[model samples]
Target: MMDAREGRRVAGQRAEGVAARYLQSRGVRILKRNVHSRGGELDLIGMDQEVLVFFEVRYRGSGSLTGGAESIGYHKQQRLLKAAAFYLHRHSLWNHPSRIDVVAIAPGITSQYRVQWIKDAIQASP
Candidate 1:
C-alpha cells in the first residue's frame, strides 16, 4: 500500500506529465524534468522559442481549499529563484534570456486536468 507521501508523489508526477504535454502542444521544447540543484528541485525546464524557461509544477487535488498557484508562497518563490540561478550558472547561460514559469494543475470537469501556464511568474531580486 502506498503511504500518503508516496501517493502524493505519484500524483505530482502525473501532474508534471500533463503539464509537459500541455507545454509541448504550445511549442515548448522540454529540456529536463525533476532537476535538483543545491537550492531546490525544478519541476521542468524547457525552451519557449529563444527563452529559457524554468517551470515549477504545482498540483492541488479537487478537495483542496488552496489552489496550486496560491500554494507557492514567498519562501517557495525564493527557493525557485535560487534553483533557477544555480541551473543558469552551471550551464553558462546566465546572460541568456530566461524566466520562471508556473504550471498550476487541478482536476477539471471537462478534461482530465486543468492547466494554467503563468509565464515570468517569478521575478529575481536585483
Candidate 2:
C-alpha cells in the first residue's frame, strides 16, 4: 500500500504531467520538470516564445478546503522566487526574459481536472 506521503507525491507528479501537457497544447515548450535548487523546487520550466517560464504546480483534492492556487501563500512565493533566481544565476540565463507561472489543479465537473494557468503569478520582491 502507498503511504500518505507517497500518495501525495504521486498525485503531485500526475498533476504536473497534466499541467505540462496542457501548456504544450497552448504553445509552451517544456524544458525541465521537478528542478531542485538550494532554495526550493520548481515543478516545471518552459519557454513561451521569447520568455522563459518557471512554473509552480499546485494540486488540491476535490474535498480540500483551500484551492490549489490559493495555497501558495507569501512564504511559498518567496521560496519560489528564490529558486527561480538560483536557477537563472546557475544557468547564466540572467540576460533572458523570465517570469513565474502557476498551474493550479483541481477536480473538474466533467473532466478529471480543471487546470488554471496564471501567467506572471508571482513577481520578484524588489
Q: Which pairs, if any, clash in model 1?
A: none
How many residue pairs clash per model?
0, 0
- Candidate 2 per-residue lDDT, tens place, 50-126, comes to 99999999999889999888999999999999999999999999999999999999999999889999999999867
RMSD of each: 0.7, 0.7
Q: How would you encode candidate 1's per-residue C-alpha lDDT over 64-108 as one tens digit per residue?
A: 999888999999999999999999999999899999999999999
Task: State the C-alpha lDDT per candidate.
Answer: 0.95, 0.95
Q: How much does candidate 1 score in TM-score?
A: 0.97
Model 1 clash number: 0
- For candidate 2, give the lDDT of residue 45: 95
C-alpha root-mean-square deviation, candidate 1: 0.7
